[model samples]
Target: MARVLSLVAAAGAATLAAAANPHAAMGGYQPATNVIEHSQIVYDIEAIQTALSADDFTEAKNIYMNGKYSCKSTSNMRNLQGFVKQATYDAKLNGTAFVDAFVDGDGPSYGPIPGSGGRLMLSPTFWDDFLLGALDGTGDFLGMSTAIRKVAINKGVLGVSTLYAAYEMESAIGKKYDDNSADASGAPHAWDEGWAFLYGSHPADDGKYSAWEFSKKRDLDFAYNSSAQAVEGATVATDMLLKYFLHGLRASRSGGVLADMVAARNNIYRMLALSSIRAALKYAEKAQNPYNEEYHMEAYVYFLVAANWVEQAYAGAGTNVLALLDFKKTEAQLSSNLYCAVKTELVPSYQPLGLDCAKVGVLKGHDDTLDDNCNAPACPATQTLPTGLDSYVPDVTTTVGS
Candidate 1:
């Protein structure tokens, strides 16, 4: 009996230690070996960005479309929601913001725009537009099915597949709000509450998102180093995210397939899949403590970005179809619906009065100041300036005679 008791105690101690260190149980998040698809998409986006920079919108659109079609119609990346479920469980058990913990110390990896930069900052505009594309089914909006199909065919190793899961998530969540409401209706409103658990607060208790957390902790067994250059695959990642919104704004305003707008939409979905996979692999490595509430909260919260992004892609698909068919009147109606969606569903409400159908397109520009200045209450200038706005620098101006 004494020996048995000792064995039992030893086992319990081992279990406790393992529970304390999340890295020990999952063997750390090993990055996928086959990143060719991700690499290809990155290259394709770089080309698109170059075209946009050169004002070759037509070429950029074509490239974007081709990248969209590059994935197969089916995915081998199956049972991806298992990760989400597990992450949710982990968050319930631990309070960590596992994936987004990087953004705080790392700075804005996602953008010049406010919510686009960090994990906790939610974007209802992004949510509204994505649902429009997914439900419309004009093209591969989330790019999940195609990506999974390709992954299955190529037998590429994936740590977790996010796109398909995102599709199902939007569908399931959107169903809750299918009935038209006085506030935001159906898809738009449903997508708005995805990360409700972490709403208002910074993703981490420290009030930071830890953008470079993975890279800094790369020596750990679970951390995967993405060999690609650029922060999150270059500034192009951030730019692509911005372009998707830009394209939607332009499409809503133009009311016609002005250029390769379809391609741009598709390309953005492709980028979404690639980035999600890269980030997931990095985060999975550090998801060690199941009892740590923050860990679980963050793990669950991390997936919301992809969820919200794909919703935008899905919604964009629908909106693009309208542009393609030249349904000016109907398109205008949907844009109005989108304005209401943000107003009602977004907490702290998206304040830009110009986001309505007639004004949004006009409001879209390279200058993020529009978003910064146009919010309902308006973001403070101190919060919106470029990185070096305050530091001392040599003034270039010269006086000929003082």
Candidate 2:
């Protein structure tokens, strides 16, 4: 009887240990080798960026619509393609003609407008009549011109990558783990797809033109001290995301608890969300004292992207935040008070998801004078800036002897 009691106690202890560390009981289970196979899409995105930067709209449109790795070909990204098309049409109809004529040496005929290093300059009415004009309507002015292609295209790619990756990870979390087969329908394949979408075929943390690059940019933007210098070791968002991806992959393959995988997935979603939110915040600060038309357009587009993602991913938790962003307002009409309210809403809304507001940091280039209006009241229906006021021109002035 004594021997039997001792044996029973040992068995109970072993059961408890197995319950604590589930993987301990799965003998001889090897983690599936990590395999990511999605570099083509990254390449396509890079090509698009290059073309847009050179003002080669033809090349950009071709790559976006017909590249081998084009998002248009992917069922999951067709909506994003639609957005690109809309932006292209608006830009062509409104701003492209002026830009083309300027680049072709007709800028002198349009008046002594500002140019960025004598490269490209639209007509003086470019901002008021085209860029900001589109912004005043409907508030969807991303990809309206070469200057802001990065804000719309690159950010859009990252948004879709992280969003669908989260979806894939969640689906894999629910399915049974298949250690033997690496087929598409298996958990391992889904996990790999999730990894591929964010990192592509590149080694961890070394990827470019995807979520990795954008996340790093946002980290640097948000890691600045009050002196406007980047603080070392302050950029943890990207690292945290990488850790979650690696750990989640391990959990999915090593017979670990599904709960661990779920935690990793949730954290990834939160970090990605933070990346966009941080970007919006940075641009909002820039919008207060916009150096040029680019800054204002960027601020609105980033806010639009971030707000839309939050609403969709968090089940409309960002509805109020979106309203505060108020895309219909012109660049000058976007008050600092409204941005402050956005920060306030974001902090508490994301707190449950482990948002450390300190990591987001304070807004750069903040101006007290701009915050005097507390409510960010609605502006007049037709908001247009005077000609040449927001144009980017060379700082050449004719001085008369005093």
Candidate 3:
């Protein structure tokens, strides 16, 4: 869901190729494994930045919306992508002025209200007519199939697999909202809120949807590293928790067969949480350079904390694997494999919007230094991993970037 432009284009083309054929996903061509590799990542980042800078707003906008939530039909990526392509291209063609006017500013634009999602406006490049290609091709327009099928229809393997990433984030946040509303102690709204709890994420708290909207309108000028990378992933492990609570606490209150739905939702949430935790941990661990161990160390600490939280999810529910699944470790010895953060950060520091209060490293008898590893005093950053973010370590004597 957070894939950059080149990835989206590549995915779009791939989806096109796949839809054209019966076996594109199964055997069309191997998708690039370097989806998240550093050079490729940095290059894509720079390319998009440069494109935006050159006021090649047309190409850039095409990249934004088409990439976020692509629409691949039964035939090709091109068929489904035109509407968004035009909408995005128009947004970029108008530049920031258009974005402000239509998206969030004072001109004629879509408001926060759901009914007014957005509209299709053609760019100078494709002004064949008013509604030829721009208005109808976009899946987000009216009645797109609300299913996982949409995700697969529009993405390359890497992009599609990560679709679940966005889904999980949105769903988790939705669960949080459900949790909030259900706690209101009113039976009607509480009953009204059951659909939200037992299903995937909702339209209201959808960060991806908002992000996609930002792109569609060209307000996507956000600095990637600065704003919303994997902030969705951060909550992946947390939201599965609502499932446990629902299964344990609200299952009785499910008003009959809704209880079964509760259990199924719980299972789905558990699978998503466990898989997301495992996948993100793999990605974070890959960031380790010789001397740098900051971002992922924080991630590890969170993983452990999430692991601990999962235990509470199943405290009295008898024996269950959902808790054990978080860290991919057995509950009988989760402590041994787990790492907890004793170090702390400012209470909500991940964004300019705010900082997050969190313990920062895994607590272990182990050391955070090369000396502890019986190596030199200062560990060296390698070509495989570039390590410079370790300057703010709380307890390590041999800190990098100090």
Candidate 4:
């Protein structure tokens, strides 16, 4: 079993580096002659944004749920559409109340999440509890509003973009980049797919001044707070990420051996994973107050998601890059320390407010809970709370006093 797991991880890493030149020795292949068109998802987001600006959220929500909008034209696959469908189904099953509560702003509030029909990937019930608790409207609306806004823009909008770009890359790599086919345009197409992930359909001809010009624009607007330092940090992070994507995209465009381009793509994916983890940690920092347990927990949800992505991306990297990032240490921090804490401390203690331990997210249907009990071996007898992520330490000593 361990050997199989190792092979699977190695295969995943190797595949990310698989966009090799098909006719490397033939000497007859021409340089890419075509420009990759803007993905259909780009226009879909434009329309969605228009609806949002017009306060037509009902229509916007419908468009999002149905996946009726245009997807990437580069590939016949409906990767964006599939993601929308899955997201909608998950939301309905686990986050109906959270989505609906924010949908109208004045509609029905948070309600019970339904039982798992298939199997839970992550628990919406636990997520909702943290979000509701964090955003109780007691301290201020900034934290709550920021959380919702980030969710809407990052998860809803840019999430589609990332999936679309990844799908295009998959198509090119799977086909081995044969320009003779409609789906494959060699390095140019593969590079463009990755470019679109960070920059969207935004024309590069225009001057790039602000970090907001890229996918991280809405991120800045939604993560608003009184602290100037926090905003500045987000800005810097967004810009750094943009620079990496842009450079990688250019490298991909410049005619080269497929190995180099593949490495560029892998590194870009690595940055994406890291940037997301940083964002989650920052959000977690904002949710540290005892009065804001909900937000604190919700931040971890994002953290876990980011950590999972990093695990996958890091598995794809070469030894040099792996050593530079110290990925094994990072993975231990995520899979061992943080994972154990979430399983033991965060989820169980919040149960009195109606969280169900049995429903906590298990890995691929395998329950790792201690003795298969949700509340047993309760948060170590010596420690008041889990250690390690002290930056996200929750104030468990006192109840919120209004």
Over 4 Å off, model 3: 1-61, 66-257, 289-402
lDDT tens digits by residue: candidate 4, 1-402: 000122223323442222432111001111122221332344455555666566565555555444433433423323333443445335432223222121212111211212111111233233222322323422223344433433343233544454345444443433333422222354445544444443433233221211123324323432333342233223232444444443433334424334443444444443344344433433333443322434443343444322323333222111112122221222233322233333332332222211132212122212244224344334222211111111111111111110
CA lDDT, every prediction? 0.25, 0.46, 0.25, 0.33
Is candidate 1 or 4 superior in lDDT?
4
* Model 4 local distance difference test score: 0.33
Q: Candidate 1 versus the native: TM-score?
A: 0.22
* TM-score for candidate 2, residues paired by index: 0.58
Question: For every model in order, what is the number of clashing pairs?
Answer: 46, 1, 8, 4
Winning candidate number (TM-score): 2
lDDT of 1: 0.25
At residue 234, give the lDDT of candidate 4.
30
Candidate 2, residue 150: the lDDT equals 43
Give the runs in model 4 whose Cα sits over 4 Å from its true position: 1-43, 46-57, 65-154, 175-184, 202-255, 290-305, 313-402
Per-candidate TM equals: 0.22, 0.58, 0.22, 0.41
Judge candidate 4 at residue 70 and give its lDDT.
41
The parts of candidate 1 lying over 4 Å away from their true place are 1-235, 289-293, 307-402
Worst 10 residues of 3 by lDDT: 393-402
Q: Could you give the candidate ranking by lDDT, starting with the highest?
A: 2, 4, 1, 3
